[model samples]
Target: MKRSLPYLLLVVPYLLLPAVVQGQSKVRIACVGNSITFGHGLPNRTQNSYPGQLQKLLGDRYEVMNFGVSSKTVIRSVDNAYTTTSAYREALASKPDLVFIKLGTNDSRLPYRLKIDEFIPDYRQLIQSFKSLPTHPRIVLLLPVASFLTDTTRQTEQAISSLIIPRIRQVAFEEKCALIDLHALTIDHPDYFPDKLHPDSLGASVIARRLHEAVTSEEVKGFDFFAAIPQPASISSFYGYDCADFTLAGRACKVVKPRFAANGLPWIWRARFWGHEPQTDIALLDRGFHLVYCDVAELFGNAQAVAAWNTFYRFATKAGLAPKVALEGLSRGGVYSYNWAAENPEKVACIYADAPVLDLKSWPGGKGKGKGSPADWVIFKNDYGLISEEQALAFAGNPMDKVAEIVKGGYPMLHVVGDADDVVPVDENTAPFEQKVKALGGQIQVIHKPGIGHHPHSLPNPAPIVDFILKATKP
Candidate 1:
């Protein structure tokens, strides 16, 4: 979907926190705030909330919690019982290593008027509640997003800015917590908030990116080393099958010799990721190295057939190819790259997995044992040696199970997937694998294209990946 506002590119400022000071560590973070943190009116709810996005950027190392209530705030008011001290107490009990607090929006709009002195003290008490915790979690005060609608709401927001923000900053300084001036940033870029108050997906994405930059800038240092790979020369072939089988051409033999041969390459060849067959496109081939395209799922029913293709990296290595052979698998093809890379760490050099089916347990086969196509079920049963579907799933095709093994091996990988793809969900395909790769200290490069589909071959194209492979496969 095209964005209505240019809010995606906005950068959030740096935040000073203990997590940043401490560098990298497995810290538990909790988002305790009101409706804004609850992700009101957002299509994805908490899945794409600020905390959720932080989880993606932070990977699996940190445990992030979203303890936001729909109609809650810190101020005490009889009409708005939802926003009260009890909410604050519950948040304190969660005992997070890091806490992000976003309030004041609802508090600013509360029906009951309160003296500035009373409001300031109440806010101070809330900060103290978390500071009093035995664990003494690091805190970040998220300034409430600015309201950008009519003059009335803007006036109300400005009122809060005048009355609450100074105090919040003072409290943050006194309590020794990190203060993120989101209020000023959002005001500067009104386009970031689509509904004029709450953030749209793009707006949320911007906030998350800013938060990530802040944390990673201070906490993350130099990255692990990875060997460079080369790019494919040109488009040799794509995923579609030749139409000769179904056309009149099937019966008509060419009067002259066919211009291109499927076996034109000197090396043994099978699958194609882009362009047409018969011509040598460096984009598809790594010179001096055998390029094995294994599609076990049958290319989602295409003749270039591959299933769990991404996980089939070991097959190429086991076939006596050089240790520098690069792998490419899209959708179920990802199944091949991930699985093969996991098992044959020593042999395979790099991977180009696009929209891969990293987890078979959830795919081809749904959570239930009998959810996939008849062929898919049969393949799983036969390959893994199981009688029942559940047993087969329980026994085989779990990419996650082999993550540690791959991480220990430390192979270079490039993962490309679409953010909006409903077919091969990012969580099932690339997200978990990316997390595992990062955790095992392996090198993985991820490219996420927004508003794209599940076809990785098309979105990221084959050139860059081929390039990555060529450079990475050096002998």
Candidate 2:
């Protein structure tokens, strides 16, 4: 089954919030204002509302309340002044410990546009009212989400950005309150706002996730770092950065974010080994590069592997990774990397293969100088759907058969080989590939480790490899 649009990217899970919190018995969170907070266009309002989704992420330790009234405004003179609403009174009486105020899009309307001068005072009054509560809740002002409308129904993105958000920012600064820039978050995805006014469930989920990040990230280091995936993943320390283990498209996946993100969010997509010889990954991460892996074990760079990587690539790029990804393949990983790169050559920035199995016939097929694994050969034959050894030998789908396509991508290739590798000899793998690439006017570099087999994958000092990747990645 193929997924498209909203169904494709939405992997939200209705998870149970943790029951215990450190200081508070149950920290009350008040979600104040508008249709988005109330989840107007969502398929399931109760479950998919921003506040409802936020409750699931924050856990049972926090009580999230929704006091949102559709088409309400902070300006009292507007058509529906939020202060006059019963939800506002109820919110004031709820005694919240934290308040998130999101009320401005409605104010960007025609009738309300004239009375917008009163917005600041009303907004400040609203904040003071919340602060005056017995709990003295910490108020967080949210800039209005970008509106794609320009008609009389709703104001345009320009109106919201120039007329509304700047006022909200001023209110945040004047009141000494924290702020979440929802405009900046939603501006990129107009598709999230189908109606140009209300966000659907997927958009609501995005808001909730961003809220989760802003609200809890500072206090909790390991909180659901990649909630874009279905469930909360285990976030263990990876070189003092966050390495999340999760599943993408039913394949086990791992993503390690850089300590400090560099411009363009450049990333390296590693194949095969998740943790073996991680120097190159770590060095790249140190220089602000995201490291990712999607397990295509049985697929083995076949069409299915290409499809899985296609989804992964879309997911990564949508999440703000660079368009072109660096490929890292170690030993058999070479098969996964090169085969996929061959299929989608333009998607690759560069290829770094270490003692890779360029031709499976050389290793698993054991039809060459290297000692072959009969079991793996059987598995490979089955995966490729080859009926016989003759058919397998006749297979023309290997990376060795993809030199023209890979070189046509116009990206450089780097190979690290052990000259004495008997498992997948350098001559049978990287050497031949390099020769083909060079003959065809392509850039290919090979670093040979003499008297070394395929035991160690990368250099102890990964400077050369790191330098090569950084240079390739640079604009």
Candidate 3:
């Protein structure tokens, strides 16, 4: 009976082990950084930290641990170095499957900024330390949120923009680690950051959502675009493609071509939103379309910008790309896209403008029903050689002025605009523009996203936008 009892005990334990082990199998994620990750000012640190929010979003499958230390710098030479902390050691020992490092905010401080040169090496070392762990975690480097402080000499936006971020990007590239751009994510939403540094509960949620998207999507951060076009002297590889960075008539010009051209060589002329909200372009690239842009920023689609586009167009066409291309403009990009299409109607296939400033007067000039950029207004005036504010106010050469030319060309147009857009109000831009186009027998489709603003440029699923471009540019 004693021998039977021992066998029974062993068999019972073995029979129950599989279920317990299966239940325990959760992907461990270590959130390693400073106060931001620590949920410093949040009312409830346990539930409102980005790591905490991330766990909720990821459900029961992910065990996210906040290994954050307050005011710690990634730069090892700095006084409060993150590497010296217990959290650092624990993070390494945890055998985490994934690690999110958000440590550059403290490094942006003026005291730490002096040791800027040490940033890259130290960051690389940190990434390597995680990579060397037995767990072999996938490390993601997060660019810190923009400092809203106007002060330049201290830990301000200038320090972040000039010193920390560029180096961080370079380190991410050098280490071949994925990067999640928190800077771009929260730059517009200053309201989210009550302290202008540490995000509140709402801001933490935003960070968690973006992190979830970046992590779960398994997107190769800074992917190399395959280049099938002739490499220009100024061109380099950007996210896995051949990219040309040169000045067209002394203005910044960029061209990104895919590794394989779609049938008939379809391409998109990105009037604006070059770096911001690139999902549409990413989708188009997947469908075999080349993405190209010329920085007509502050030009407001003036004659100079048109000339630059003409030069770019000739260069692009001569390089064996399709003659007619789709135009993608977001916000101010609408002016460049529509103005260029109006001037050279024969070269355009379709136009997709999102919350676009079709009328410059509605935006920079502050002439109409929108809050305008006084600084950009000066640039807009200078670009057109306007001698006075009165001249700018009376200027008749806006995109709306060229509606006849655009409509005459039989080009299809799509506008994904916010009904609540006050910056480039639909009443001043798309509403009037659509009415004119339709009255003149032009084909235009408007997708009005309710309760949205100019901030979010594209739909969650860019399929409809991509479908429009594909159908318009079809051979």
Candidate 4:
């Protein structure tokens, strides 16, 4: 049927429009912050800033604008207040669907620290200002990265820890805004910050990856970990078995390819002890399960440590390994295993923890019956930004606190503990944890060795462990 020219033109254009144009709309994201957002000190400021990287990561469906001014502060009373900046006005004018606030690093400066009392109210006001906008953006508060500067007077990590972050947390809670813990993300990674303040290119990439994960509710997978391994790296040989020594996210990593690849290339993610317990790894290698490890020693499975593991997981999975991994933790490695598993429940197949330090309070904090390491305790507290023993006691992010999530994910856990262990006693660490898991209706198997201390992690034969792993990770 012939139609009128004007009507036919309109109808044809509408019908011929691309599916994308007719479907979901683009998300407008306004990245509002200071020098960090401004991409200062970054070589390729236009392309390598967190916002710029976020745009690439988000692809065509998102418009991530970098509206950041150098030396800007959330506090209006500060010498260079973000409220007075043109970037602030531009951010408001952009009418973004999402706004990420990464201020307060500059506010922690000595001059602005004096007016720190005004921070909460000022931050609240700023948040309200965004809320009042017609767009009513979904605001996310980013806790600032830790300062690496030795001069405590000018820009102190203590100021951010003691004054800024607590207030930021309160603001997010009160305002019902999402919070991304950048502080924890960058805490143990001092190498990320080249100038002791600004993040280098790699550091910015990490931040962008984290932000993308938060927004999309998806993990950044398929990183080529082996590609990042430096040239001329030495392969460690154990009894004619060769393992490639590589680096993932600047951390030491080892990959032992299986004799035969499983259907999905199912691998065992050794949380720690790359070479300590050869029996289990060798057995797994014989069974076509690739053995992998990324060193995260002394981190105690804090947010930073978990983040590193998350990166490693992505890299390994992308490198043709299985999407789900069987976690093996021996002694203190238990902390890394359970914590990483808890954070990423769906990615884990099962867990095997031997003589594990399930709770930091037992082996590290010394809050319980076990004899703790004083030096390690200090490091633990500092890694997590724990100011007092009371805070450490009250902290609930431990593996013990994550039983519900683990159960919900349907991940069965196995623990090997020593009954007479004093360093990390079963009575203090594994016993109570197992009880809680069972009480919560979670699947947990415990193998207790009597008259054994914390030493001699993993099984001598490893046949039983291998059997369990095979069953758990069966394709």
Q: Of the candidates shown, which would achieve the greatest TM-score relative to the real structure? A: 3
lDDT of 3 by residue, 342-363 (tens): 9898899999999988888998
| lDDT at 343, model 1 | 54
- What TM-score would every model get versus the actual structure? 0.40, 0.54, 0.58, 0.52
Off by over 4 Å in 1: 1-26, 77-90, 110-115, 151-155, 219-475
What is the number of backbone collisions in each predicted candidate, taken in the order shown? 48, 1, 8, 0
lDDT of 4 at 263: 43
C-alpha root-mean-square deviation, candidate 2 = 19.8
Candidate 1 achieves a global lDDT of 0.54
Off by over 4 Å in 3: 1-24, 150-154, 218-224, 231-268, 271-291, 294-326, 330-432, 437-475
Better of 1 and 4 by lDDT: 4
Between prediction 2 and prediction 3, the one with superior lDDT is 2
Better of 2 and 3 by TM-score: 3
For model 2, how many clashes?
A: 1
Give the total clashing residue pairs for model 3: 8
TM-score of 3: 0.58
Task: Give the Cα lDDT of each candidate.
Answer: 0.54, 0.78, 0.78, 0.77
Of 1 and 3, the candidate ahead on TM-score is 3
Q: Which candidate is the best by lDDT?
A: 2
Worst 10 residues of 4 by lDDT: 6-15
In candidate 1, what are the lDDT values of residues 1-475, reduced to their tens digit? 1212211222221222344445645566778777778787788876788878888888876767777776555565444433364555566776567778877776555353353455556666777767778667766777666777664533266666676666665565455455554564465567767767787776677667656644553211111001111122122112111111111111111000111111111122223342322222222321222333332333332212223333332333232234344555566656555565565566556766767777766566665322445667566556555688568557544666667776766668888778876766777658877887787787899888888766534431244554576567543
